[model samples]
Target: MSRELDLKSEKSIEDLKKLSKEELIIKILELEKLRINKNELVNEGKKIKRVFDFTKCQKRHVAFKLLYLGWDYQGFAKQDDTEKTIEHELFHALTKCCLIESRQTSNYHRCGRTDKGVSSFSQVISLTVRSNGNNSKELNYCKMLNRLLPKDIRVIAWSPVIDNFSARFDCTSRTYKYWFPRGNLDIDIMNNAVQHVVGTHDFRNLCKMDVANGVTNFTRRIISANVKLCSNNDQFSKSRGYDMCELTIVGQAFLWHQIRCIVAVLVLIGQHKENECVITNLLNIDNCPRKPQYSLASDLPLNLFYCQFENVNWIIDNESVTEVISTLQHNWASHMIKTTMLGEMLKNIEDLVPDSINKQSDCLLQGVKSKIYQPLMKRPASESLENRIKHYTKKGRLKIENNEKN
Candidate 1:
C-alpha cells in the first residue's frame, strides 16, 4: 500500500532520503501509523487493537542483559564526546533497530557503570517494547536487533519484565576479579589480608571519589572477599609469561576506583612487602579525617566479573543472544593469548646473560642517579666535598652537611 502524498509540485517525493533525522522520525511515525492500521484490520479478525504507536508511552517493553570485554573500549557508559563506550554502541542498536525513541527516553537502564578498560560478564539493561499477546513473539524484537549490531557488542539474554524491574536498583550483587603476575604473590598471605575489607567500614580515603555526582559518601560493605591461585595454569618452559598471579573479589557495591585501591593493598600484602598491622591501620574506622597515603594498582588487570539477578523471573532466549555471547568470548580469548605471548618473550631477557660474568645488582641502580646532579658533579670532579656543598647551597635547591677530613 502507498502512503498518501501531501506534497506540492515544487517538492519532489524522490527527495525523502535527504530528510533530516527529526524529519525522518516524523516520517517514520507517519508510516508506522499507517502500517499498524493495515496490519490490524486484516487480523481484527477484531481482537487485536489497532492502536498507532502502541509502544510510545506504553508500559510494555523488553529488557536485556549484555556482556563485553572492555580492554580496547573506553567504558561501559557512553558520553557525548567518546565513541568507544558500551552505552554508545547499545543506543546505536536501540535506535537503528527501532527498539526505542531518541536516546533521551527512559526506555533504557543498565545495572552498573564499569570504568574505562574494565569488562563485564553479565551486565543487565531494561527497556520497553511493543507486543501482541501477553507479550507475544510477534514483537520480533531480538531477531531484528541482533541482525543490526556489530560483533563486539551482543545482547546475551532478554525477556518481558515488570515496569519496576529497574536494572540498577533491583540488582542483588556484583562480582569482580583482578589478575596479577603470579610468581611472587603469596596466595595464603593475600587471602588473609582480604578479610580486612569485609563488614561495614568508612573507606573515604581508599576510593577515588567522583565529586561530580554529589557522592561524598565513601562507605561500602563487603559481602565476601577472597584470593585464590589458579592450578594447572602456571607458565612452563614453553608457555606464555602472563600466568604469574590471580585474585578475585565479590561485593554488593564498589566505590569509584575502589577495586584498584583494594588490589594495591592486597598485592602489597601478597608480596609480603607490607605488614598486616599497616593493612589494619589503613582499614580502621577512626582513621577517618586522616590523610590517605596508599597508591592504587593499575586498571588494566581488573574486570567486572558478573552482575547478580533475583526472583523477578528472567526469560533468556538462548537462540537470541547466542551470537552476542560468542563474539565477545572470541574477542577476549584472542587478545589474552596474544598478550600472554608478548609477556613471555620479555621474560627471556634473563637467558641472554652469561653465567660466568653476571653484572652487579647495583649496575642498574648506578644509572638511576639524578641526571641534574650527575652533570654538576661531572663538571667539578676535582672539587672538595665542602666546595660542592657550598656550590649547591648558593643555588638553593639542595641542603647537605659536609664532614671533611684534611
Candidate 2:
C-alpha cells in the first residue's frame, strides 16, 4: 500500500495541481478508514474479545492499582516488550479468566512506574473492564487471577472507584518508608530532622531527578514524615521486642527518588554527621533544582505504604472477599511452614545480609571516620537514583538560578 502511495506521490506537483486541499484531506481520511478497518479485520479474535461490536461503542470499565512484588517478575506497569509485569500478569488473567481483551481499547492508565526489584502495597492504576461486574463475577475474576498469578503478587482488595476518582490527580497524598537498621542510628536526631520534611519545600536536592520524560518539577508537599525504631509487625514484638527499625515518610505524592534522598540526609543528620541546616539549606528560596548526591536505598526494603483516595471507600467487601482473605491466611500458614523447613534443610544457602539488617562489625567507630558508612547488616525496605551534573542543571533552571550556565 505504501509503495502504491509512493508511485502516486511521484507525480510532479504541477501535474497534480488538479486536486484541491479538500480533495487531498478526503483522500487521506478515506485511506485512514480503510487502514483501520483492515487492521481490525486482521486482528478479529475468536473468543469474548469480539463479544462487543466496537463499531457501536464500548462497555463500562473499572480500574485499580495492581500491587505486585517485582523482585522475581518485572516492573509494575505493562509494556509492549513483554517482560512479565503485574500488568502483563493481570492482562493474561483478564483475557484467559475474566474474558476482557485489549488494554489500549480498555483505556488503562497506571499511576506510576516502579523499577525491577521494587514492590508496592498501594500502587494504583486506572482501567476500564466490564463494570457491571457483580460479586460473583468479581470473585471469579479474583480467584481465577490468583490461581494463575505468582505467589509474590496478589490483588488484596478492590473498591468501585468513582468516575472522578483519579488514582493520580485526585489523590489526597502518598506515603513511603525506608527501613534502616537500628544499629548506631540516632533515632532522636533523625526524628527531629524529619520535622523539616513536613512543610512544603524545594525537594530537588533531596531527590534524584528523573529527566527521562522531561520532568523537572521538584517542589512537593511533605505533609508529615518521621523516623522511628520500628520493632516488628506483630504487636507482641512491637511491645517487648527491640528489633526491625525503620524510617517512615508520608506525603502528598513524591518526586522521583525523593524519599531515599531524604532518607540519606536524615541518616546523616541523625548521626550528627551533617548540620541541621542541611535541610534548610536545600530549602533556600534562591536555590534551584539540583541532582541528588545520595545513592538510592535498596528496592525490596521499600514498600508503597499506602495511597490516599479521597472519599473512595477502599474497604468495600462482603463474604466472598472475606473468603479470599481467609484462604490467604491458610496459604500463608502453609507457605511459612514450608519456608521454615526449606531454611533448615538448605543449610548451605548463603545469607547475604541486606543493607537494613543487623550487624556485628565495628561500624560505629568506622562510620565516624569514613564519610560513606555502610553497616554490615541487611534490613527491610519501604516505598522506594542518578547523574550529578544533569540532575543539578535541570533543578537550577527550575529554581531560576544561574540561567547563564544553560
Candidate 3:
C-alpha cells in the first residue's frame, strides 16, 4: 500500500507539471486548503492567540531624535480627520511593534509641531516605552522602528532621560531654515532687515493671531536671524536664478505661521517693495494694532534644522547610524539626479530667451501675485487682537475676568 501511494503521488506531480500556470495556481490553492483543514483536525481544537504581557517588561523614559521629509505628510501632529501624519505613523509603529500599549499611556510629548510640507532634520519626541535589561542590553529602537515606519520618516537616535523631562518644555531653542532661489533679491538689504527681528518684541502684527486657541501672548525672543548664500561655490554673475539662499531664524518659541510670515515680509524687503524698517514697524503693536493681510511663504522649503537641549546624553547606535546614512545617501542621489535633469532643461530654455527680460521673483510664496504691488502698511488688515478676543469670548472659547482675558 505504501509503494502504491508513493507511485500515485509521483504520477500526480508529473500531471501538475504539464498543467498551465493558472491551473497550477488553482491546484496549489486547493492543496493549501486541504493542508489547513488537516491541521485543524490534527489539533482537535482551535489555538488561542497569545497576548503580549506588558507587566513582565521593563519600561524607560527616553527621547527619540527623528528626521523626516514632510512634503507628502499632512503634518507632524496627528489630526482627528486624517491618518496621514508623522505622529500617526510614529504611534502606529510603536503599537504594532508592541513598544508601547498606546500613545496616551506612553507619556508622549513632541519637541516641535511642524506644519504640512515642512521637513525636519532634528525633530525630537519624548516617551516611555518597553525596554530591555539596561543601556547596553536595550532593544535596537532605530532598527525596530525603521523597519515598520515609512521610508521618509526615520528614528535616527534616542536617549534615556530623567523621569520629569519633557521634549516640549525642556527644549532650549529651535532653529528654522527657509530656502529660496536668489532671483534678483537684494541679499544685503534682506540681511539688514532680518537684524531688526533678532531681539525680543511683540510679534502679534507679524503672525496670525490664534485667539480662539487662547494663544494671546505674542512676545517671543529671537536669538538670531539672517539670510545667507547656501552654497560656497556660487558667484553673483553666475547665479541666473539658480543660486539658493536661506533665511535662518533661531528662537526659544514661535507662534503659528510666525516663520512663514516673517519670510514673506523679508522677501518683500529683498525685492525692494518694502523698506528694511518694515520689520521693526510691524513689531510695534501700538502703531499697527492689526496684522496686515498677506500670504505666507510656501511650506515646501521650510525645515526644522535643529532643536537645542541641555544635559541629555544621546545614545548613538553605530549600526543604526550606518544604516541611516546609507538610506539618506540613496535618497540624496535620487533627488540630485532629478534636480540636475531639471537644471539642464532650464539652462537650455534660458539660452532661447532674451537677456532684457526680467527674471521672475520667488514663486514659493502662497497666493497669486498681483500686477500692482501694495505696501505692507497700505494693505487691508485683519481684526484687532482685542476684537478677536471679544469675538472668541462671545463664542465661549475664552473667558474674561476683571477686564482681562483669563
Candidate 4:
C-alpha cells in the first residue's frame, strides 16, 4: 500500500511540472492582485482627516525674504491663465503649511513685480500669517515653507514687522542685475553708456508705456548703473567669448521693461551699432517724443539682487542657513558642470574655425536680428505716451487724473 501511494505522488508531481508557463504566470498575477487589494485596504484605513482652525491661531505681520530661479516660471506675479508663477507656487506652499488662510485675507504685498523668467535673490513679501504666540519662539517659517515649496524657490529668512508695514510701498530701493557673456562686447563703452542713465529722468522713451493699467508717470530715479566683469580672473581676457559680466542698476523704482530696454540700448552701444549718447537722447523725452521700436534684452539673465528697507531686522536661522547653502552648492555644481562641458565644446569648435567667424556678440536680445543694422534712434518709433493714454481713455480702460498729464 505504501509503494502504491509513493507512485501516485510522483505522478502528481510530474503532472504539476507539465503545467503551461502561461497558467503559472496567470496564477502569480492573481496572487499579486490579492496582495495589492489587501494593501489598498490598509492604506485606506490609515488615511487621516486634516482640520486646522485658523480662527484660534495667533497671527503676526512679517516680511519674508525669498530666493528663486525664475527660468521656468512665467513671472513672480500670479495670473488667471496659469499657476506657473512664483507667487502662485508661494501661495500654494503657504496654504499647504497652514501659514495663511488665503492670499486675499493675508494682507500680502511684494517688493517688486518681477517679469517672466527674471530670477530674484532678495525678493521680499510682507504678509500676516499664523504665529506661535511668541515672537522669540516663533515658528520656523523658512523650513516649513521650504519643505512644501519647489526646489527652485526658497524662503531665506523672515522678520517681524509692524502691522502697518508694506513691502511694495515701503521699499527704499531695488537693485537689479543682468548677467551676460563678454562675447566681443565693448565693456568699457557699455560702462560709460550706462552712466548717462543715472539721476532722475522721464524714462517714458526707455520703457513700455502702461497707460491701460493706469501707470501714467514714467519719471524714476536711478541711483547708479554700471557694468563690470563678474570674476577677477576673467578680467584678464577680453577676447575670450565665454567670460561673464554683469550690469547692476540701483533705482528707487522702475517701469515695465525699463531695465531691459536700457540694456538693449547699451548692448547696441557695446556692439558699436549705436553711440553712447543714445541714452542721453532717450532720457530727454522732448528729444525722443516716442520710444523707438526696438527689442528688449532677454529676461533670463535678469535678477532682483536686493531690496533695501528701513528699520527691518532679518532673523536668520543657523540650521536653515546651512540647508540653504547646501542646496545652492548642489545647484551650482550641476550648472557649472554643464557650463564647463559647453565651454569645452565651444573651444574645440573655435580651434577648427577662423576667429573672425565668431566675432558677433552673443548677448541674447529679443526679436530677429536685422541683416542691415538700423541705429536705435533711427528705428521706427512706437505711439507716444500721450496717444496711448488717450486711446485707453477712449476705450474706457483708463481714467487720467487732472494732474496726470503734467
How do all models score by TM-score?
Answer: 0.67, 0.63, 0.85, 0.85
- Highest lDDT, which number? 4
Residues 281-349, model 3: lDDT tens digits: 899889998899888988999999899999888888888888888989999999989977876776677
Candidate 2's displacement at residue 392, Å, is 14
Model 4 regions lying over 4 Å from their true place: 1-50, 232-238, 356-360, 400-406
Task: Name model 2 segments beyond 4 Å from true.
Answer: 1-58, 79-82, 131-140, 232-242, 285-289, 315-406
lDDT, candidate 1, at 1: 17
Give per-residue CA lDDT, model 4, range 98-170, as digits (tens).
9999999999999998888999999999999999998778999999998988889989999999999999889
- The better candidate by TM-score, 1 or 4, is 4
Model 4 clash pairs? Answer: none
Summarize candidate 1's per-residue lDDT along 253-371 as a digit string, tens digits.
77888877777666656556566455566566464344344445766767776778776555666677676657767877998799678657654765675542222111111123333
lDDT of 2 by residue, 356-397 (tens): 332311232211344465331112221111354366556663
- Candidate 1 vs candidate 4: the lDDT winner is 4
- Against the correct fold, how does model 3 do in TM-score? 0.85
Clashing pairs in 1: 60-129, 61-128, 61-129, 181-244, 181-245, 182-244, 182-245
* Candidate 2 worst ten-residue window by lDDT: 376-385
Candidate 3: pairs in clash = none
lDDT of 4 at 347: 60
Tell me how far candidate 1 lies from the true structure as C-alpha RMSD in angstroms. Answer: 16.4
